[model samples]
Target: MLVFWNARLVFLSVPKTGTTAIEGAFAPHADMVISHPPELKHAPLYRYNRFFRPMFERACKVEDMETLAVMREPISWLASWYRYRQRNFMQGHPNSTHNVSFDEFVNAYMRGDKPAFANVGSQAKFLEPRPNGTRINHLFRYEDQSRLLNFLQDRIKQKVSLERRNASPRTQLDLSPETLKKYQRKFSAEFDLYNSIS
Candidate 1:
């Protein structure tokens, strides 16, 4: 999607899902790169984070770059994200916010209330045509990563291979009948979109 748009690819890093590894791999290939702002510098970073801000606006105007992101299934993604944060961010706090289990997290995600799950960009928005009727040229599935990379190579005329750097921590979950219905309802559009494209 980024290469296709000829705009600087923004990972829009959601928790876990190997964002760091992906950024590391793509940095050399990118003309410009941005990563998570350091803890102390986060406030300052946000002041300058807008793509339309002066520092980036001129560059954006001159360079035809593409912004791209990846997404995963919400239930699986949220479960892994929760575990990743519990290990990395919630270390030794007096009160911990990481007690939720996979099933609990999935319930919240299905309701679109979890921050990690909410952070992934909207596929419907990404796929919708612009006012000028231009649609994003590509949107790839993490499940179909090899094909996505192959398609990118074909577009750029360059050979690139990506290694799988991370996998979901919760490998198994028992979904109740009610929970299954919630997931289907919550992600109906995405499921439809995937089927149409596939």
Candidate 2:
């Protein structure tokens, strides 16, 4: 997560949504950057409200900072996770996807008891609105980099450049129609959230 205190903006890093690239690009300009401890790095809305929000509200006396996030197409997001875990360094890890087909991986993901390899967190849950109505002020589609960059440049008043970082391995991934249907049904919240992003 990158906090632009002067801009009164907080960019929440949703995993696998090209947030790493954005963080790298904006790190120099950000007032505070949380890049360690994956849990805090990808602190979701509830976490933000529980932790960061109170800190700012009490200490900084800041109550209206806007938040930003990005969501990728659901299937592609899952595919990225599958490929990401297949990297060489993760070969023997319990969460490695080295031996699983994309189909099997996704099937496991839908299980109530997901295997470590398929336990990636949901994008929808990551950005869910808080009960207090704290929500993202600017939500961008990961595929729509132009708009995201445009918004950042306008807000920060500086030209921004991005270089791809932490890309998942290349692979041809296709979900069978039946599996896709099941996934959509089971994870309707994810699809609904992405669709609502515009």
Candidate 3:
């Protein structure tokens, strides 16, 4: 996450949404950057509200920071996770996708108790609004990099260039039509949320 205190903006890093690249591009200009420790780097809306929000509001006396986050298309996002876990080093890890097919991984994800390989968190859940009404002020689609870049440049008044970073390994990923339909139906929020965003 990158916080631009002067601009009253915080960029929430959603996993697999090109946030690493975004963080790298803006870290130099950010007032505070939480780039270490994956948990903090990808703190969801609830975590932010629970921890960081209080810090800003009570300690810093800043309560009006706007939050920004990116959401990738659901299937593509899952594909990234599948490929990421397939890395050689992940071979014997509980979350490894070493010998799993995309369909099997996704199917496991739909279960009440997901296997580690298919337990990647949901994008919609990550950005869900809190009971107190805290929510993302600006949400961009991962596929729409130009819009995000323009918004950042306009807000920060600087040139920003992002390099491709932490890309998952290549894989031939295709889910069966039935499985795709099931996934869309079961986790409609992810699709609905992405579609709602311009």
Candidate 4:
């Protein structure tokens, strides 16, 4: 997460949403950058509200810090995770996807008892609105890089440049139509959230 205190902005890092590239580009200019401990680095909304928000509200006396987040299209996001877990370094691990087909991986994801490989958390849940009205003020589609970058540049008053970092190994992701339909039916919330981000 990148917090620009002067800009009254906090950029929440959603997993598999190209946050590494953004962090690389903006870390130098950010007032506070949390990049250690994966749990802390990729903090979701509830976590932010519970841990970080109080500090800002009480100590900084900043009650209106706007939050920013990027969300990828649902299936595309899953494909990224599937491919990411297939990386060579993940081989032999319980969460590795090296042996599973994209369809199998997704099937596991839909299971109530998901295997480690398909246990990636939901994007929708990560960005849910809080009861106190602290919600994402600037939500961008990861597929649209221009708008996200433009917003960052204008807000930070610095030219932006990005280089891909922590990209997963390349793999063709193909899901059977039946599996796709089942997934969509089971996880409509994911689609609903992504579609609502216009």
Comparing 1 with 4 on TM-score, the higher-scoring candidate is: 4
Q: For candidate 4, write residues 97-190 as lDDT tens digits.
A: 9979999999999999999999999999999999988788899999999999999999989997999999988897889999999999999998
Off by over 4 Å in 1: 1-18, 38-68, 91-98, 112-135, 166-172
TM-score of each: 0.62, 0.98, 0.98, 0.98
What number of backbone clashes does candidate 1 have, counting pairs of residues 3 or more apart or in separate chains? 7
Model 1's alpha-carbon lDDT is 0.48
Residue-level lDDT of model 2, residues 82-128, one tens digit each, is 99998999989999998789999999999999999999989989998
**Model 3 residue 59 distance off true place after TM-score fit, in angstroms:** 1.2
> CA lDDT, every prediction?
0.48, 0.92, 0.94, 0.94
* Least accurate 10 contiguous residues by lDDT in model 4: 129-138
In candidate 4, how many Å is residue 129 off? 0.8
